[model samples]
Target: MNSAIESLTLDVPDTAAAQAFYDEAFGLGDRLRFTTTDAHSAGFRGFTLSIVVAQPANVHAFVDAAVTAGATVIKPVAKSLWGVGSTLQAPDGTIWKVATTAKKDTAPPSRTVEEIILLLGAADVTASKAFYVDRGIPVAKSFGRSYVQFETGPASIGLGLYRHASLAKDAGVAASGSGSHRLVVNGALGTAVDPDGFAWAPAEVRAGA
Candidate 1:
């Protein structure tokens, strides 16, 4: 399947507030849709939005900006075994993990955040993998019973799964019960919803003149 996570659709208490935060902090600009109306009434848990960067400076810059944008600072930016890192809770309640891996070459037009990986916490990783596989989303990598990363293009935006309890612990939040996700994946699995409630919708086709 030619699938990629184009942007995240989060259910925020205030759309304008959420959009302003993302735009100011990460330069996401119009890449995020924060809506006050919709299925946002359901509380979200069981997932994380990861921002992987190539440099420690980028990580620090992002964390600093997020704080200035009024995000709840969950963990202050610091060097950990993983790399320079930090955590924040968006005004809308989405947990964001900002960190850096080994340094790599990055050209101009560079942004503070590099790649966005949406990791869903599943009750059963195997079952989740099978569900997507049946839908034609290829597996790029998998580790026995622990994790699975779906095949996506070089754009670096993709989907994956992990054990629910384990993921919740790692994110410093309690395991959440199943509910709707503020996410949407675009590609071959047009207009479908996963077992976990994540949506895979087709891109809108506009009329020609």
Candidate 2:
């Protein structure tokens, strides 16, 4: 029952342009360019990113399950290059490829975190904490209702439950919405976003890694 962030993907308007932007900017993973007739593509590991354009299915179910509370349907599920899937609009307005599992798991994330640390907002922290604890991802640490850490994943991942206001406060910015990005890598470096919107970058790792 360790529901870790095995992988993450997204849907973009210009696949080539976006992919190139990521490559030049972050320098995370290699280029895994493929086309999905219904607007689908993925960018593998990069400087600070690991997710791609191939996500697990159940786009609606995901939203229903509250995995994505403010998430919207950017593109409904339908046929594509590999099979069935959809382009979803994350709460942050970021598009994701909610593709069917039939699509091969292309970009496996880095083992850096070993466990995924998900920080939920203050309001949802309590109940969400119970949900993961019950599901079996060990809740290892807690800082009042502000934060709760869960032991999860093949990598050392720990999901946190917290509030955006607090996170923004730490970041020295006005409170805005948020979203999750799936990251993949070979050896070493693991990445995660802190209470602040800024990413807690993973340490450098090897590629053949």
Which candidate's lDDT is highest?
Answer: 1
Model number with the top TM-score: 1
Instruction: Kindly provide the TM-score of model 2 when superposed on the true structure, using C-alpha atoms.
Output: 0.39
All candidates: TM-score:
0.85, 0.39
RMSD of each: 3.2, 18.0
lDDT of 2 by residue, 168-205 (tens): 34323345433333323111123543223223333333
Query: What digit string (tens of lDDT, one per residue) describes model 1 on residues 118-209?
Result: 89888789988998889777898999888999986665466889887887777777675545566666555678877666677765444681
Alpha-carbon shift of residue 90 in model 2 (angstroms): 15
Give the CA lDDT, 0 to 100, for residue 127 in model 1: 89
Quality of model 1 by C-alpha lDDT: 0.73
Distance (Å) between predicted and true CA of 136, model 2? 2.0
